[model samples]
Target: MNWPPVPQVDLLEGLHLRYGVLATELRLLSDGLDEAARTFRVGVGNGPDLALRLAAGDPRPVTYFVLLHLRDRGVDAVVAPLPTMTGEAFVRVDGLTWSLYPFFDGADGWTHGMDVQAWHNLGSALRAVHDVPPADAVVPREAFDVTRYDGLTAWNAASR
Candidate 1:
């Protein structure tokens, strides 16, 4: 897929300074058209193929907290963004949020298969994520509490 061009120098420098991994090569793994974020496979100096994503939005602290909590709970399936040197999950560069992910090249897209098992597996994964209770003090209860506006519905009904 044709990904929107990455801000190469800015992103590379951010990753380098934060992670201490000087990546000599960067390749576009996928475009944001399907995932809403561009994924990049970075070839660091004799290390694993690290994955990084550039997302066009503010870094959601609560979401990252939940991810870390899930990881702590032994749900290895949940791909949490790796924290930077100062422990921030995302780095803001050129108005975009760049976050690091462990490269899982085996991940298949939602459209990969059109079968019952695939659909069931997708549903099960979603259910697993929904079922995980937010960790205490990881993401505050206030972050989950939402008051409805004129037309916007707060999705965190269970948290209330």
Candidate 2:
């Protein structure tokens, strides 16, 4: 799938510098990845900058939960501007990236208001996903767990 062009990493690096993760600094990382491989495979339209900022300097549990939960549910389908996660790193999607999804013919955006069946299906999906037992997962906490109001926080190399 061909994705639209993305902005430079420096544009997001400023934002990432405010947070902790480099999902914001997509340009440089994106420079190496094939746009075709990174689409939908990368950050779905949730805007990696926002997700990264929200996840930055938080507890290991939150980070683990958010990332794991998103992965468990296949966030690629939900987030519009999919951000690609190549191992631990995340880069923005580009035209070169591609993923073969089961073709669903339709326009984008919500087509219906809340329906009983839709709610039920959403609930069912969430329940099933949550039921997946957490295995022996290790989320080592970083040293600067606390994030201040202004944005800058200690990114201790201690936490991995």
What TM-score does each of the candidates earn? Answer: 0.68, 0.31
**Residue by residue across 73-148, what tens digits does model 1's lDDT show?**
7776689988888888777876667788888776466546557877787787777777788777675555554444
Q: In candidate 1, what residue range of length 10 has the lowest lDDT sum?
A: 145-154
Ten consecutive residues with minimal summed lDDT in candidate 2?
94-103
Candidate no. 2 TM-score: 0.31
Candidate 1: list runs displaced more than 4 Å.
Answer: 1-7, 31-36, 107-109, 114-131, 138-160
RMSD in order of candidates: 8.4, 15.7
Cα error of candidate 1 at position 11, Å: 2.5
lDDT of each: 0.75, 0.37
The alpha-carbon lDDT assigned to residue 156 of candidate 1 equals 56
Which pairs of residues clash in candidate 1, taking residues 3 or more apart in a chain or in different chains? none
Error of 2 at 107 (Å): 12
TM-score of 1: 0.68
